[model samples]
Target: MNIDQLNTDYGIPGNLTFATGKGGFPMIHIDNGKAKALISVYSGQVLSFQPATETTDLMFLSEKAYYAEGKAIKGGIPICWPWFGPDPEGLNRPSHGFVRNRLWNVLETATTADGATKVILGLKDTEETRGIWPQTFELAIAITVSTTLTVELITRNLGNKSFPLTQAFHTYFQVGDINRVEVLGLENTQYLDKVDGGVEKTQLGAVAIANEVDRIYLNVTNELVINDPALNRRIRIKSSGSKSTVVWNPWVTICANMADLDDTDYQRFLCVETTNAATDIVEVPPDGEFRLEVIYSIE
Candidate 1:
């Protein structure tokens, strides 16, 4: 476990800690002594970040955490790279590709010019990975935490070859009430409704999830607000390098079928994903780079 400890004063309460596993993979965990994130300093797996202050959490937690062995933390923001879900072409491959489930390395860490601490987590293709997609690549994922949390994915081809992939942060947010919460900013946008089994439609008024919802909106801008009236707080989502937004809530019957997901957990969480799907497929030329960034702040 190669853990990169964040810069801190001798006894400061909460500070950041970054790590790389046996092969120098990247993962960061924060512990202010108040909210201890149960993590492995080596593997980039956020096994658990639940604070004791809250009894029930809305974080993404794997069914049974096996941090030392590098099982991708099931829930949370599993960075789906090269692909999302099952490939429509069909294969014996894993879901969302192998990035989340595999271990990554800590490439570098430094304070940013804006006074924010930036830690870059990196993962390169091994001979084993080449079997799946024979492309030499470098995926650098940087996380900066200040008043808000910013997760950035910057990919480059180091093998003198082109790389094409689909990706997302798969962010799961904790909410006070699914009913009282309404997602604003998608008023005039158009979305491909998945609940109707992949039909396209334009959204009307503010997006509300009174029932099951799954729609992937195409050509998005930089803002989304989760108006949690019950909690009297707003969860703001801002993004760059993305042209899509996927709002999903596995409501009603779907919630009960997910063994890893708590049945009634729907009441406390919502997945308003920031993505570049649909007509927004990202392609990187040989030796070229592409970046997609997403930032979330809760108030």
Candidate 2:
């Protein structure tokens, strides 16, 4: 709980802000500004966010990709690949599957013997990803934001051979309304809709999230509930190695074409994603090493 090192000036100019976020871990390393807005401050609870700015900005505006950190909703932490949506098999070779536009390197961060405040983001297996799927891998992304905000996705398989893949952490949450919300523990179970596009629905009980709700819940064993009755609290969305769970709400024409979103920002926000991707891929094998962990509690 000692994460300080900021100096606002997203005004941009020669940018090279290193990165450091530990105040309690919601994220904020604006990297000398330039759209480095990972600003959640953990919870002062504002509304409109997305200030990452540039560095190739792959469209997720808060200001638009600042240092372009790994990826997060429109905030920070986005590492979905091989397939999370679209191209289920249409020349699937790129786009949203190489670790969010690729560019993560910040290996170790400290203080955690019960003090909690770690931050290790990494990715490897280059040479153009073993030429579109061969093997050799090492992708680690660990984040521990004190009170609440723990995102981890570690997969290592330095190729001896085996290395199957399919992942997701495309989580985009920022709610206050989204129709008052209701995602409590997926009652029935079974989802996979992608939009009206994939279609494979199920869960028909305690999980009300109105309109454009994309599904992808299969064999998932509980750990979700965004019942944000307008921030009264209740955002516990836990997950382990992963079984399957990807609920979304882009309603209202994708929030009016998203320009930083906020035509009511889909009422506020909801993109409960915690997946293993497509048919739940993760074959590690070779040197073996596969993991996925996400926690954002605020009950």
Candidate 3:
């Protein structure tokens, strides 16, 4: 449906509305008194979110991000599905799967009991998708906007055979400054440092960003906290159905090289993803499903 049709059919008066956003993509704007959020139906991505109590948004979006078709936006909670990172089969397919770039179907919208707004978007296997991964599956992302923002990603196997899957809610959080941010709950966890040739290392203390960092932390705790002293608030992340997590910041050198990000964009955001990556893959059985959920709240 077009933006007007979507608004006419699914919009909640004074709460949720649909309109054309950057790059001419259909966007969902939500404001239910407690918080405000923006979602892109084109990428099935949550572009921005902020509770009424906070002055700044919880998510970071790069101003230079590509809004065109087939290019993933530089920030927000991008859904990396079916597979994360490089193609496992060594095909020249896009990194982090193709779902992030495809348009999603809006399935349902509702107002929850506590006055929260919920939106569910779906994507099923198509001829074009099957041509890339050949897996028959259905994927849905149910997003709830309340005082706290919650996102749940559901994956169902439609084929008779089981399929291995690795995915992530690659969340880019906006911070006053990257240097003033320290991630808690990852202390003592072992991770594969991608920046250091994928060497195995253990986190000894709170994660602090001083330079380029790309690590897949394994067997993580259920809850993590981003203590942003500059922002003067702590963002807590609670996740379920995920044993692994990813922490990344493309610091100065790499930040200068990315076309979708400004040279200083790296200093304004931090990625502490909830994921099932590296060796923590899950196999979805035929007719069965898996869920990855995360809740974000600030204090």
Best by TM-score: 3
Q: Which wins on TM-score, candidate 1 or candidate 3? A: 3
As for candidate 3, its clashing pairs are none
Tell me the tens digit of each residue's lDDT in model 1 across 122-191. Answer: 7889998888777898887876645456778888877676766777877777777888889999988889
Worst 10 residues of 2 by lDDT: 42-51
In terms of lDDT, the best-performing candidate is 3
C-alpha lDDT of candidate 3 relative to the true structure: 0.94
Candidate 2 shows a clash count of: 26
Measured by TM-score, how close is model 1 to the native structure? 0.82
61-141, model 2: which lDDT tens digit per residue?
333323333333354446675456655557766555655654455556544566444556666777877786656777777
- RMSD of model 1 against the true structure: 4.6
Q: TM-scores across all candidates?
A: 0.82, 0.34, 0.99
Q: How large is the C-alpha RMSD of every model relative to the true structure?
A: 4.6, 16.2, 0.7
- What value does the lDDT take at residue 214 in candidate 3? 99
The list of candidate 3 runs beyond 4 A from truth reads: none
List, residue by residue over 1-299, the lDDT tens digit for candidate 3.
Answer: 58778988899999999998889988999999999999999878999999999999999999998889898988999999888999988998889989899899999999999999999999999998999989899999999999999999999999999999999999999999998899999999999999999999999999999999999999996599999999999999999999999999999999999999999999999999999999999999999999999999999
**Candidate 1 at residue 30, lDDT?**
60
